[model samples]
Target: MTASTAQQVVYDPYSAAFKDDPWPVYRRLRDEAPVYHSQKWGFWALSRFEDVRAAARDHETYLSFEGIDIDDTAKDMSAPGFLPDIDNPRHDQLRRIVQRTFVPRTIAKLEDDVRRVVTGLVDRFADTGTADIAQDLAWPIPYAVFFDVLGLPTTGSDREDLVRWSHGLKDREDDDPRLTPVAWDALHDTKDYLAHVLTERRAHPREDLLSTLVTAEVDDHDGVPYAPARIDRDSEIVGLAFVLFLAGVESTSALLSTAFRELARHPEQAAGLVADPAGIPAAVEEALRFDAPLQVAGRTTTRDVELHGVTIPAGERVFLVYGSANRDERQFDDPDRFDVTRPPQRHMSFSEGLHGCLGAPLARLEARVALEVALPRLGRFEISGPLTRYRSTPNMRVLDSLPVSFTPSGRTS
Candidate 1:
């Protein structure tokens, strides 16, 4: 083990001040204590760009089985590990199944579907002159896309149920009731709801992710599989769905909100996309890196590790502040400035290496088409009301509400 550092670092991710905007504190931590140790959380932290990138990249040393939520309880830990956390052979098998549904070829088939959905939201709001972007537009896109891909209904109470549950999971410790063990109740219910979906897919397997997983086979890493044709675990299926639904809704919606906010704040940038639709994809990438939906992620140390000469003991959690790292001057030039043409630099927004976001391409495509389709059609829109930022979890930077004014294209010209 490397020598332990003298300075104790305290940056509770749950701290009230840190939630609203943590850049200043993160910047200080990067320079002051690159390997800050927090006894409050009983873990070590890596805030600098180099440290965070390295931690995320070295999945062998810093594994993600710990789960993303800083406040995860025994219940959460007890739940089956999802795509984001599972390691190796099993991960590869499950991923192959999940990927079948979300790959570009499959998603491209839904371009018309996405465009139709986008048009409906914009059209409804165009006549009304008001709509909450996060609620009405941003939040529903992914759910619509997900369910449509799965051959499920995109309407009814499940939409509302999922939305509330989604927000509940992201709230600040005090604000988001889901922060407590009480959230497990909701998690359990969500599990039940998703379980039904699994059963439905099993009974009537379709050409979707669940159906594919229902039929896919896994071989043991030790080659101990009784049969390669065995069915996947049902509990794992439901657990992965729960995670997928949440991941699909939360991060994409957050990114959408951020993208909309950026456009509203910088009409010129919005105009740039509107003028040349080709630029929207690049714009989305910059927005992703600039104000990432997932601003922080980490790994739990499997063994004692040395970070910048500071020893992080085994079995301790290490915070990898990608929100800070994304803006690191050392890694990105003019790191704070938001430019649409960022040349697709490898930012830690989706993280790196083994556990990086599996839905990256899908997310990027969603963002690109969303902004391209909506911004031009919704004539002149701006944040007409007080913006309500989503509750900050250690893992996400999201806006809860973005009330806006939007005029339709025909009505404008």
Candidate 2:
């Protein structure tokens, strides 16, 4: 990890090499160059735990107006209502619109519903003894739950179309930060779908979050007195729905699949969970820390900041490496090991501060319930097929497929 080796350390977030295994590069960055600059991508990165956490908390200095992805998809802020692209006082204003629905107490009420969904999914393959956990369990649970939360149509061709479009929105090219044509089509179609849903909700109001958003209002800060006004812009509303759908479905999917895959690798830990179901929550947290779904968060520095004798100029994109920071030895003991008994520690997987993930509570609940229900049924499971990574933006780390074989219970719930 000398300066020459550091210079040899090419950290390309979008490159296939980095995606295959980023931990080694992350280690090099943290050890040799704490504040590493990627000249090719024209962005600076902070890989250390403390640095990333501080930047995430300092929303003023490390502004998020540029969006959280290093890609061009949200850089210009063309996609209205993408929450990560918005800054306060508008950020806070918009967040308040749907924040209550995501609070722990509110999300807790959905436990039964989440469990039902998990049970249904797990039952589908429970008797078969072999299943692609990612496709069969991880991906669909969040889709069913979040779509229900939004009151979106989750049946027939409507659900099929939404799932297709959602997957399209996540498409990304290797070693490139630009959105693919398929992604663009998916983006347009999703917005169009949301627009149609919003219109329907307007015509026939429902008791769901989307209907609430249709009639929601916030202070119009552009005015002198800042009077309360209805959110008139359709793009803003659509943007809100879009981000929610994407984050809600994808992040949780990644979390669940990763947890299961790791558990298969560490059967002893899985055994620990089966012996004591209460440990499932801590296991979920450990999974998040060991391998975060969202790898990096992007921000723009409003002022020049000095770190590790490296100065990042004002108004440049900075990558807060959440995936790397979570594994930093400076923060966690034996950070590389996946120990279910590891002490509860704060990790940047869900991010931090004002712009922290709104759906984290729901994600945790889903993962916990998913493992709780699936593990007992999947006793002593082993990976049965080739593993594949999800083809997504550089900022994400998720499996596209995880096939597992286990002793079949010969019964379904």
Candidate 3:
């Protein structure tokens, strides 16, 4: 843990090699530098479990007005209702507007709908001995379910445009933290579409989340004296829809695909789930900790702080490396191994504290039900084709193509 060793450890969030496998570098950061500063990106990183968790909880010290992504585009252009980019009073106000929708009880009520989506997708390929999990199952289920949750059209050109825009929003280059031209276009189009939806909802409110967003109100704490005000800002509503749609679809898809991919590698674990479908929920937690979808979250230090002999000045960007923290040996036993029966434990996959993922319950339900319905059908499946990682963003660890060869089974209801 000397300066020389620390210097040798290159922690690049935008590197192609790092994206392929970041664990080794993550380990080095935790052990050698603990508080890593990258001159290339002009940001500091916290790789250990305690440090990242602590930072996430200390929202006052680690302000989030700069958005959660380390890229320039997110920090510069973060709009209203981008929950991760807002600080409290306002953050809490906006979050409360939609919090009830994501509560466990509310999300649980959607199990039937979620299952219907999963079953339909599985039916399409369950009888076929070969299939791509990413395209055939992982990608479609979230898109269908989330779009339904928002009362958006789930078919035809509309769905196609949303899918395209989601991909475009994530487009980035290796060693570069700027959004690509495609990403910019995607962002604008997505906002435009959401704005249109909000306008429609204002004119004719429906029994949908978008309608609620357009009509919801909050206490105007930032205004002159406190008063109730309508949450009618077009940008805010659009931003809320944008984050919910993009994160809802992309993160869940990544989680589902990663779970299946890991199971394909460790057939014994897959057999465990096949034997007792009850263990599927635990399997989902393990998948999240084993390989988190979104890796790093950005924070700006509000006051000078010292950690492990490094003094980060106030107003500096800090990255809480959740992907690394989840695997910190200090927190979990045999952190590298994938075990569905690891006795449920807390992890940074969904983040922590005030900004914890609002859609977690829904994501977990979708993953558990998808596995329960699909695993038995995909008995002894093996990864048949070369696995390709998502090129959307360096922070995401998702399979773009996960072709599997399995024993064909008759379609199930």
Candidate 3: misplaced stretches above 4 Å? 220-234, 410-413
Provide TM-scores for the models: 0.88, 0.95, 0.95
Any runs in candidate 2 off by more than 4 Å, and if so which?
A: 1-6, 76-78, 220-234, 410-413
Ordered list by lDDT, greatest first = 2, 3, 1
CA-lDDT, candidates in order: 0.71, 0.88, 0.86
Give per-model CA RMSD.
Answer: 3.6, 2.9, 3.0
TM-score of 3: 0.95
Q: Which stretches of candidate 1 lie over 4 Å from their true place?
A: 1-10, 73-78, 158-160, 168-172, 175-178, 220-234, 406-413
Which candidate, 1 or 2, has the higher lDDT? 2
Candidate 1 clashes between residue pairs 3 or more apart in a chain or in different chains: 390-400
**Candidate 2: pairs in clash:** none
How do the residues 47-86 of candidate 1 rate in per-residue lDDT, one tens digit apiece?
A: 7788788888888888767766556532253356377767
